[model samples]
Target: MATAREEPQTTSRARGDGLYYGWVVAWTSFGVLTITYGVQFSFGVFLPSIARDLDVSRTQAAAAYSVYVLVYSIMSSVSGALTDRRGPRLVLAAGGVLFGIGYALTGAAQSTWQLIVALGLIAGLGMSAAFVPCNATVVRWFAHKRGRALSVSTSGGSFAAVVVPFLAGWLVERTSWRVLYLGCAVMLLVGLLVASRLLVGRPEDIGLTLEDELGRRGAAQPRPATADDGAGATGAGAEVSLTPRQAARTTSFWVLVSIFLCTWLVVFLPLVHLPPFAEDLGIGATVAASLVSAVGIGGLVGRTLTGGFSDRVGRTVSLAAVLGVQVVAFLVFAVSDSLWTLYPAAVGFGFGYGGTTTVFPALVADLFGRAHAGALTGLVFAGAGSAAAVGPFVAAWMYDLTGSYRAAFVLSAVVNGMGLVLVVVLRATTPAHPGGRAAEPSPLRGTGQLAPGRRR
Candidate 1:
């Protein structure tokens, strides 16, 4: 393991309000996610221009993203494992360099093949370093406050979704798409490289204890206990963490995989194809991009609102709500021909999409425990989120075939409905542990505590 850089125990926590350094780590990670995701999602706004410039078909342009998503999702496993072994600072620094180089090459690509190689493969490899390492590292920093911290960190994508597409829309109108891409390259290179220096892997890594941990444990507390519950419970030594390998061996993990797979398979249909869909309806370029912004706006509300809301209602309830909203959004898109309907549909779509990203990772931590959170979270995200690659391509292919997005929209609703059903049925179908007790609702169930208003 990479040695953590030394700092005074009070180094990041010297704030007057006594804000923990974990928040700093969380927000810093937020900055990186915002920029990366902003540029990624804004690809939709740039798609028409890119397709026109490269003399490529829409399906070909969409395939670039499909390849990128596939490569990025698969690479996340490696990045997450690396984050656990080497620390996020090193992982993020390397990612920044690779990510920047990929964008620079993307801006300069002369052909479809080059675009795929640059953005699809190279940039995807770099992006794999972003979600897993950033969120996973934050998990190591706080225990009891994990869900809140994660909501803040992941909201960068939502915030970026809100702002970046509009910014890209305006800039694309004023400048060449290539120029806009080069600007992103410069920012990713400079921003993540500098920000990585501010990260500390864990509170204990620097000889510091969480405020709640003081006077609670001796010097020899296990790492998992520090993460499973902040300061842990009475006889904290009894708590255990599931390794990524161990997590894979359990049936609950596969159920999570299925839940996420269904949601992610169609989540990107609107984000990647919505702007073009709006344009097909005779909306102006900038206005079409604003459709993306609408999604972002709802996403901001969803993440900020639902992230905390899930803590009270339980993750399953929160997940069901998110999927349910998406089903409605897709149904509206399928049935409505009126352009105005899209605005609300887009907002609802953003709400569901944003909320799922927040709850699922927290659920993984809640179920699997947090000692190897990076690896386990990566596993879930990679296994299911990889399906996100298919949405854009399928939508594009559908558009090419039928000259309408109606069928794809209907398919998306069905898929999201499946995910909702999976989350609902999950609690009952989970197998009992070898010890003859249920471990599926898992970390919460293991503790013999139901969410408020529930009977055991």
Candidate 2:
């Protein structure tokens, strides 16, 4: 059903130039995530300012972020369904506009309610739109390289985490937080333009098929597509496909959801409150902000390394190890007061946190298959979204009541330990194929084998 204008001409150029267009998709996804999550993650930098400026309690200020996460989680499944039907370009375009407008409006808010409406509801919807489509698109584009490609694309968030907090903190010192929000709005608009131009729904929309190594080792060859063929027709040979309902029926899905929930509960605690926590310890705001940047630095390494490592070590093992590190990191943060101690703790937490972002998507695809990846991943992400919504608020309330972050940090460590236990259980319970990949053969029916010369 693609219009003539919608069909990509890049397919022909890629065939002639000997470069796969899928890499283009990967980098484009990277750019989108970098800009969106970069701005999104910078909320901690703005949190203190918002509290000081609006005369709100820490719990009230944190509520804006909580609401954002709540709305974002609710919208993710909707966006994922839309992406499955309408494609990423439209979804991303809408996201860009919504994110820009919502962010810009936050600059004008005079009260906490206005702030929540501008940032929590509107901007949250925008982020929801951008996340699943880009991730699901990348999963569909590569088979042999799915994990690496997803990692590379998601590493943008880690890269953003490293840079944005420091930059926002520095800017807040020199300028108003309002200007920062407006600047982010402009950047999102530019990202939308890029997404509209380059973000295709599937590789088949451009006349290229998925990489040959995507299917079973000895499956039959795919038939050549005729000019009249639709995108679905061309992609009929994808190795495995599944509906969201079908995937939801499996026990592994619930296990994955629980893991996501616990990890995210721990992840968002530091992300939303790390700066204030550091400031409470007598660290300067700029220096406190650097703690966030340190997390980003560690995350950058974690995301990239975990992606490629999971391919070799298997997803469950990599996940369990990462969760174990998170538990130790939280405990470190709970007991430490010195900047020297906090820095290493930040790096450790960030590294483990970054690994989850990379591993979860690849794990979902590995377990459920690529066909309905967007919807299923979105459904799974609802767990994280719920955790994101609740975690910060809980931490803020705990701090307000107890007059310290120690209890909150201790709670994070405990939950993360619980996550590690779940990962172990998941690993033991989930069935694996002969090659060690999660079994997904039911969805592979009718998807022909890789072409002879095209196998990896």
Candidate 3:
């Protein structure tokens, strides 16, 4: 195996086309997320219409959401292992196809059980493959701009949320809920086709090297986190190029995983609650539908702004900000009952949630290095996915008991607070490097500043 520390024989600078190539890779990652996570995020838009059309109870229809999350969470490991083995192209393309097929099949689903199998299981699995791999690939392609790149690409999920819900809602108004699914199927097909054309399998496949991707043309550079910086997530025998296995032995890996899981738990609970919460407040159906789109818009704004900010301020700062915003948003959510109050809550929550997606992948790469990035991120995301699976049900159970969403809202606040606490703990405990081992300080430590003799 080619060790991460061994510079690639070829560099993107040698081709003088690395910048343009990096954008291509970033766009590809965006496309992959658009179909998979985008569709997944839009599920709430179809909830009321799907339930009315199918004659299922809201609680029963909610099962589809539960199943989708369950499968998505459960399959994350498999997706990561596969991404590391096959590269992202096949994995993302397959996800696109599976998602497209799942939506198409969902249009024909005559029973709740069939919908679960089609949209929940098949589509969820597809998204799992698409999202984790695309995230890992972005880690490979951009080093300097990793935060911004990941923020931009992962923001696609929020973009889809912003767009797909409104589109689906309009389609439902114009035709039927089934047709909405058919439209999604067609869109997913197109997204998959685009991903197929654009997604290069690896950096070597695209004729680039990792260094060309370390930061932006004029951005401040942060040093890679090292094992000794209280970041021994990469264990012994590790160097500049570290892999997931190398990082697994360290305390940072689990801490990162724990922190993210807390955030995701908060993230998914609201996804399930948003549409109905608006409906319960006596908001107009169309307006409520539009609110679903607002989350996406907030996410787009959040991801774009936060990702770029992380490049300048550092990943930890951005992460902390996102968690803080989430805390405030959930606090608003717990008290709000009208559109006037809830609209702002939706925007804040979506923005914070969306930004979290953008920051997470870059943070993972910063903490662990790129050698085993795909596998490590996969494992970390798997924990987040598992949290997502349980979160909605927890919300539902709370609602079932209270006959009101207040308890659920309070619970979301608590979960977000937990994430904030972890963020504090993370900063306090993690070293800038790993293993207390000093060969040369990791280039990724502190910030990506050059040594005294090195050129700017």
Candidate 4:
């Protein structure tokens, strides 16, 4: 405990040592999320096996996953709040234990009820810790590098999507699903437990300032952000300190929530429906599956490239660009049935989705400041993240009512357009004297919105 809390000031002690320790935190976060998400996503591969072995209906068996999503999504707010007060160490430790034991229990279960209790409740509780703490902690550690740091951390899920399911399919062919779950339990336990030890809550705890950690003196200062820098939320280096409650009072906070709600609402519709949509057009099952891989690969590329791009351009401009890409992708899905076109559309959707996720947190920190980043980020996620669960279901419903997926695809494009418009509106009309002229003293009292000087 002491060693973890008192992690060496390796990033700031000298430049000769190597890269900043925040990068270490970012990579560790990536590793932990990879294992956690890989295991979580493998649930689909296990679903049919579990249903057959347990003698349950597919819907009955799948209810466990639905419950798991609901539980994890709701628990994120609680975990995020915990991260703010006690730091990530204790939160991650608890999550590791819960996840490990829960998954192990899932392996041993003989009934659907046990599956629900173990995976849905216990493992779901544990899954909540994977995202909020890791990204929020990284935010606390870096100012100039926040976007790139979060991009690295956020890409873990995409990487897992690309690799884990195929790996699970291969492993399941060789062994029972129970055995796979047990193996995953072991992997997640080791990965997350070790990661908990590597993370620190903030650099200040180790006697470092943000600048010192970036580089000696001003040598490591971020190259000035481009003119689009403050377009969506905040100008460079301006800080806002607001608790979750405090943030909730501001229009910008709600605007952010709405923005993400719109983003997430359309985000999963394609991922869930694309396979069938392709198959409906008489594409081979093998080709249909490959489209998912295209999305995953595009996601990996998007986050890797766009995080640094957001750092250079601005989170808002980057967000608008990606959202525009999404609008295009959905329109493609709406208007076309060609194999050649669908492949690129899938990649474009994945790229937009991946970039949106990476930008979300960096924009949060930029607008709200890092002081209450975990709680703030968590609240927005809690409010908006669940939209992912709905988008697919709603799209399916729309498909059921109508004969074709065209309407659903068009609807998604429209919702995506709404989000894009919100992004533009937010960037354009923010009051130059935000919070009104009577606004609180700044150190300039600026945060949440940009001032004119920021443009210069």
Candidate 5:
């Protein structure tokens, strides 16, 4: 009995309430994250085995892992921009094809070089396309439960981190490494298919609004930008006005980069080195590998808790607490020679590490604005990725030279502590972006109102 206008409005309201396509988008994206990032994270589990079977140096095999991180990290800006322009379905589908091709080709590799190019370069590029775009898209669709939605989506990465590595590691034991690649291809393909069906750039495409969905659900509402938020929200959007050249000119940017870089060096150190480190401590190989599983478990809990809590507390305080825990975890790793100590270290480090993905995005959105968050966060992440590129090689070289991983662990702790200092410095230097709401240029102007306190 609804009139024509009322029917469309009613449908929009229902969809906005997150009763239909929003949840579908969340779960579809979740499948992709769980699969793509899962495969990416599981590299640590396969590192030792790949080295032995291929007769390559551990450092050499580790470089493949480094490549994925580098690609995924460096391409965030481009991918985010592309997602905005084209849409998640195309981005994700293309990523799937490329990722599958990378893995499929990897199955034919006879040398470490081949694996690096295929898994590292090609697969990494695919991940870049799929992962960040999906995240950005999901964030666009659900403002109220953004924390919960993002936490759920990102936890797919953690779940895959645990399940893929353990499952792939076991498969390698029974079949071959090549078969493992095949499995990755299958998962990636399935994810791509799901994305085609479920993914959209934003609720507007489906005639829905986030406020309609989550607002009706009575989810926690994000504070609207007010005069106070203007300084923080300036210069954030799909395309960064400041290229690398202009961005490099800012002291705040460098300080932020320094903080992110130092933290990442330590992040991958434990992620890539933990399995080998555990084995060195007299833990059995399977059990040592299983310990890697714990990292994923810890990440799931950490990201969920941190994302939800940051909504209540401020983003800055939540970030500081998470990073502080990371420092403590590193200290534990540095001194602990036993499995008992190492177990706790893994839990703490994994939690802190995983929490970064959730916290950093929100931080970026808060400081700049979601519009610029994609590109700005991409630039910020590249710094961290660059640091990650060097960490594994350095950790491996140090272990080889010293005949022990203790020094490496100690060094990681020291580096993390340095990052802590940078973060403090960043906090002290308040941003000057005209309150949190920049005056919109003609091309970018829209009807959406800035949350209160953002407009000067």
Candidate 6:
């Protein structure tokens, strides 16, 4: 019995013979995101079918997704707190169960209310539980490499974007939308089983340390005070332990919330309406669905590239660049007259949208230490969720009013531009370190290095 117990301890502490266990966490997070977001994003593929079959207006149909976003966003803070307090295993397990059940039931809904309950409330809550925890967990596993780690983990959503829409489009061609939900349920079940076995809450929980640049275990170096440190001793750049309440009191925290809210307002507009908009343009269902897949493809590239890019360029610079790309993409989407133009537009928007997911969390970690990462990230997401809740519905309402998506698409571009402005202003205001300190010079200055007890 003692040998058996000791064996488990040895395995936990093994560190994969010099391979950081954090990579395992990153990949496992990737899997969970792939499954969760695959189902979440597939809603677009289902939108046209559901609206046609149920005989509901586009605004009503889009409301289901709005509800889903609302529920998901509202629960984010609660779930983040749970993940922080109890670790991610239980939260993720619950999420998988809810996700599977919610999709399965959504498949059976006979009315709009039933659809809302199944997809919006249940599935949204499940996604809330699963999504934030994965990002939070992966962030805790790496210090200097947090941006890359986040990119790798979140790329799962991009992967899902590529695969799920195409798969759903194809499947819906052969099977009913109901059948698609059943398929989502099965996928979630299988993904959860695999994730359960592999997910680790943190490196310390498994007796490992954060990896340094050389991929060896090393202690974090102290942050040397810089010239700006004396001027802004209480700014965001200083290294100080902060409770969630304390962090909430700072100007940076509220600025992040505003930025998240505005960014996602634009981000989710297309996510919910893109497929339907294509269909309205006389694009075939399969082809329209492929547009979403295009976004996913662009997203996959963006997610992967931005992680490393942000690590090199400052997060604010990288964020502003992607947001600018989104503005251009949305403008193209707003005015495009043909499917050819639409396809390129989708790629641009997807790239920017995917990059936002990567940069925002890293920005949060930069502004707030990882100690309350789960809660802090969740707070940011709460704003995003709130934006998502209204953004699509507003677009749908615009469509209802104008009989075209042109106005909605224009609105998306405008909001993205606003978000870009906010980011630029925020970068100007935030200190490089917590407590208003100037950043120290280091070999990995832009590659996401941080002081001990803090993370970028």
After superposition, candidate 5 runs with Cα above 4 Å error? 1-20, 216-223, 226-254, 430-456
**lDDT for each residue of candidate 6 in 125-215, tens digit (9 for 90 to 100):** 8889766888988877765677799899999998988888888888887989998898888788667866967777776675555533234
Q: Tell how far residue 272 is off in model 3, in angstroms.
A: 2.9
lDDT assessment of candidate 5: 0.68
Compared with the true structure, what per-residue lDDT tens digits does model 4 show for residues 1-456?
A: 875654454644524366677777899889888888778756655655787899985456656765676677677888888999999999998889888898999999899899989998999889889888888898888876778898899898778766776577567667888988888888887788899998988877766657655566445454332221233324344344666776777767788899988997767566556756776789754456566666767788888877899877667778999999999999999987878999889889889988998998888876666788888888888888766666655665676677578998999999999999998877664543442321111211234444332211
Q: By lDDT, highest first, what's the ranking?
A: 1, 2, 6, 4, 3, 5
| Candidate 3 local lDDT, 1-456, one digit each (tens) | 464433243343434533446667788778667666656666676777777878986666778788888787768777777777877767767777887888898888888999899988888877777777777777777655677778767877888777777776666667877877787788877777677666655565644554445423223334443422232423322335445666666566677888888888757766666777787878766677777677778888899999889777666667888888888888888888787877787888888988888888777776656656677778888877577877776676676677667777777888878888887776655333333322222323333321111000
Instruction: Estimate the TM-score of every prediction.
Output: 0.89, 0.88, 0.85, 0.82, 0.84, 0.89
Superposed model 1: Cα runs more than 4 Å off: 1-17, 210-238, 429-456
Candidate 5 per-residue lDDT over residues 25-121, each given as its tens digit: 7777778888787777667777787888889878888878778778877887677767767877777787888888898877777798898899888
Off by over 4 Å in 6: 1-16, 211-215, 218-241, 431-456
Point out where model 4 deviates above 4 Å. Answer: 1-16, 43-62, 105-115, 172-175, 217-240, 270-289, 333-342, 395-408, 431-456
After aligning candidate 5 to the native by TM-score, how far in Å is the CA of 49 from where it should be?
1.7
Better of 1 and 6 by lDDT: 1
For model 2, the local distance difference test gives 0.78
Q: Across residues 1-456, which tens digit of lDDT does each residue of candidate 2 receive?
A: 456553345554454544577778888988888888889888888888889899998899889889998888878888887888888888888998998899999887889999999999889988897777788888778765777888888888889989988999999989999889999988997787678678777777776676333432234555432111222334335454557877666666777888888888768888878888999999998999999999998898888899888877677888988788889999999998989899999999989988888888877777666667888788888756567798899999999999888899999999988889998887665445444444322332213211111100
Sequence-dependent TM-score of model 1: 0.89
lDDT of each: 0.80, 0.78, 0.70, 0.75, 0.68, 0.77
lDDT of 4 at 367: 65
